[model samples]
Target: MTLLGDAAHPMVPRFGQGAGQAIEDGFALAVLLEHAKRDKIPARLKAYQELRLERTSRV
Candidate 1:
């Protein structure tokens, strides 16, 4: 399984991004998985990772 938010990118709590990032992760993952078939789950998850990685890194 893949990880999200702090589980994927742990960071200091001073900026308070933990919960926000987790919510963002959940929404993004949900969108990617919404229409995915069993055979497409891997691709959807990878897409979610790529998108979130870029986004969270920049935040």
Candidate 2:
């Protein structure tokens, strides 16, 4: 249901961040999903997007 890294924000290979961002996404997802409640999934994903979107946009 949630996309990460290239799936969320594809970039040129010149950036050299596809893999790194994917790892970061995975890490963040793990933390956000830990003991997450069904009702809170949306908020958790929103938090993930907020955390990553800004950084990826700058990159």
TM-score for each of the candidates: 0.90, 0.88
Question: Which residue ranges in model 1 land beyond 4 Å of their true spot?
Answer: none
lDDT of 1 by residue, 1-59 (tens): 78988999887786778778988999999998997899999999999988998888977
Task: Give the number of the best model, judged by lDDT.
Answer: 2
**lDDT values of the candidates?**
0.88, 0.90
Residues 1-59 of candidate 2: C-alpha lDDT, one tens digit per residue: 79998999998897578888899899999999899999999999999999998888977
Q: What TM-score, to 2 decimals, does candidate 2 have?
A: 0.88
Off by over 4 Å in 2: none
Q: Quick one: RMSD of model 2?
A: 1.2
Error of 1 at 8 (Å): 0.5
Backbone clash total, candidate 2: 0
Model 2 lDDT vs. the true structure? 0.90
